[model samples]
Target chain A: QKEVEQDPGPLSVPEGAIVSLNCTYSNSAFQYFMWYRQYSRKGPELLMYTYSSGNKEDGRFTAQVDKSSKYISLFIRDSQPSDSATYLCAMGVDSNYQLIWGAGTKLIIKP
Target chain B: DAGVTQSPTHLIKTRGQQVTLRCSPKSGHDTVSWYQQALGQGPQFIFQYYEEEERQRGNFPDRFSGHQFPNYSSELNVNALLLGDSALYLCASSLVGADEQFFGPGTRLTVL
Candidate 1:
């Protein structure tokens, strides 16, 4: 199995809808979790970051990590069309020097 | 401050050719890391450079090599490029002890 697994979602959601993207991992040593958003033809942009298990909120975005289940999620509240992009979940063992990433889930927030 | 900057925003090269891509870390940052993002995939770490030395590397083969300069800028060199080497090459920068990486507009390489 891949170290990190994420659904290759071309998930479409209507604007203002609640959006939830998730990934599961096999490594228990991963302690730092991150969410990145990438627009077409652009590099992945850092969105949310967290250490271990917990919930972090940034405006309309919320990231939660469940170490027990080896799963992590990014929730977008009141999604907008501008939010359409690929979302990637990555984990680091101890520091930022090494990060294991998942195949991103592509999202489309329709107007 | 300027974010990470990569040169030759787009490149087209024939298979078996070699190419060199350069990156200047974000202002005030001292470490540089390179990643490869294939179509429909998340960015994969290739390697990282700190203090003019290779600090970490991912699963990529020896055909993929890199260098860090005294000014904290870096270069990624691909030798014996294959069709599979075509991808969006991304450069990211972070300060020492800083975990979050800020990325540059990547260089898109197309191996013909």
Candidate 2:
């Protein structure tokens, strides 16, 4: 199994809808979890980061990490067409800094 | 202040040729890392450079190599590239031992 697994979603939703993207990992040693958003032909931008297990909120985005289940999620509220992009989940052991990444989920917030 | 910057936004090369991509880190950052993102896939770690030395490498073969300069800029060189070598090459910079990383727009390489 891949170290990190995410559904390669092309999920489409209407504007103002809430969107939830998730990923599961096999390694329990992953101490740092991150979410990145990438627009077409652009680099991945860091959206949110969390250590261990907890919930972090940043404006319209909320990130949740569940260490027990080895799962992580990024929730977007009041989605916009500008929010359309690929969301990637990344994790790593804090000491090594070598992140294992998921394939990314493609989300589109249609108008 | 400029974020991470990569050169040659797009490249087209024939198989068996070589290509070099460059990256300049953001100000005050000393470490540089390279990754390869294939179509419809996540970025895979290539290797990392710090203090002008190779600190760590991923599972990539020797054909993939890199260098870090005193100024904290970096270069990724792929020798005798194969068709499979075609992908979006991304450069990331960060402070040493810092978990957060800043990325460049990436160089899109097409091995024809």
Candidate 3:
């Protein structure tokens, strides 16, 4: 199995809907989790970052990590059309080095 | 402050041709890493450079190599590239102790 697994969801949600994206990993050594948003033909933009486990919130985005289960999630509240992009989950044993990434989930917030 | 920047925003090359992509890290950052993102896939780590040395590498072949300069800027060179080498090449920078990396706009390489 891949070290990190994420559903490649082309998830479509109506405006103002709640969107939840998730990833599961097999490597327990991974301690740092991150979320990145990428638009078409652009680089992946870092969104939320968390070390160990717990929840970190930034405006409409919330990232939660469960190290015990090796699962992580990013939640988008009140999604908007501008939020349409591919969301990627990344993890590293050390926050300063190489990261393992999961295939991103494409989200479309319809107007 | 200026963010990481990459050159030759887009490139097209024939199979068996070599390509060199450049990147300048963000100010005050000393480490540079490279990743390849194919269409419909997540970015895959190629290698990372620090202190003008190769610190770590992923499962990529020897055909994929990189360098880090004294200024912390970096270059990725692909020798005798194959069509499969075509992808969006991304450069990311971070300080040794900084966990989150800042990415450049990336160089899109197309091997025909």
Question: Between which residue pairs do clashes occur in model 1?
Answer: none
Cα-lDDT of candidate 2: 0.93
DockQ of 2: 0.67
Per-residue alpha-carbon lDDT of candidate 3 for residues A1-111, written as tens digits (9 for 90 to 100): 999999998999999999999999999889899999999988899999999688999999999999988899999999999999999999999887889999999999999
Provide the lDDT at B40 for model 2.
95
For candidate 1, what is the DockQ?
A: 0.77
Q: Order the candidate numbers by lDDT, best to worst.
A: 3, 2, 1
Give residue A65's lDDT in candidate 1 (0 to 100).
Answer: 97
Going through the candidates in order, their DockQ values are 0.77, 0.67, 0.86
Score chain A of model 1 by TM-score against the reference chain A: 0.97
Evaluation by lDDT, superior candidate among 1 and 3:
3
In angstroms, give how far residue A28 of model 1 lies from its true place.
0.2
Residue A28 miss distance in model 2 (angstroms): 0.7
Best by lDDT: 3
Docking class of 1: medium
**Which structure is stronger by DockQ: 2 or 3?**
3
